[model samples]
Target: GVASVAISKCCQVSDVFTELCIASRTKSKCDALAAKLAPTTRTKITTAQVDADDVQQLCDLINSYKPDLVMNIALPY
Candidate 1:
C-alpha cells in the first residue's frame, strides 16, 4: 500500500516525507487511501477534491500544497 511505499522511500533516502497531498476528483476515495496509509507511515497525508482534467484546478491545488513533487496517479479517462 501507500504506507509501504512511503516507508520504502524513507528507508532508501533516510528522510521521511512529512507532507503529502492526494488530489482526486472523488474526495472519499482520496480520504480512504490516506486513512489506510496513515497508520503505517510517518508522513502526514491530506486529500483535496480536484478534477485532474482541469488544468487550472490542478494548478491551484499544486500551488496550495506546494509539494516537493506531484505524483499524478489519476485515471486517463
Candidate 2:
C-alpha cells in the first residue's frame, strides 16, 4: 500500500521534509501507515481528513498543515 512515487519524491527532497498522508476516510489506516514509516524513514507522516472533491475542506487542511506538497491518494470515482 506504499506510494512508491511519493516515497521516491520524498527521498529526492531534503531529508527533513515531513510526509503527511491525508486520511480523509479512516484515521486508523493513516495512523498504521505512519507508524510503519516512522522508524525506517527520515520523513515523518501525519494524517488529516481532506476530501479532495471538497475544495473548501481541502483548502482548510492546506492552510492548517501548510505542507509543501499535497498528494491525493483517493480514488476518482
Off by over 4 Å in 1: 1-14
Model 1 steric clash total:
0
TM-score of each: 0.74, 0.67
User: Candidates' lDDT values, in order?
Assistant: 0.70, 0.64
Worst 10 residues of 1 by lDDT: 6-15
TM-score of 1: 0.74
Q: Name the best candidate (by TM-score).
A: 1
Query: Taking the tens digit of each residue's C-alpha lDDT, what string does model 1 give over 1-77?
Result: 46435434643442456677776777897788778767766777778899878899989988888878776653456
Candidate 2, residues 7-57: lDDT per residue as tens digits? 546645535675655456566766666676666667666776555678898
Model 1, global lDDT = 0.70
Provide the RMSD of all predictions against the true structure, rounded to 1 decimal. 3.7, 3.0
Please tell me which predicted candidate would have the highest lDDT against the true structure: 1
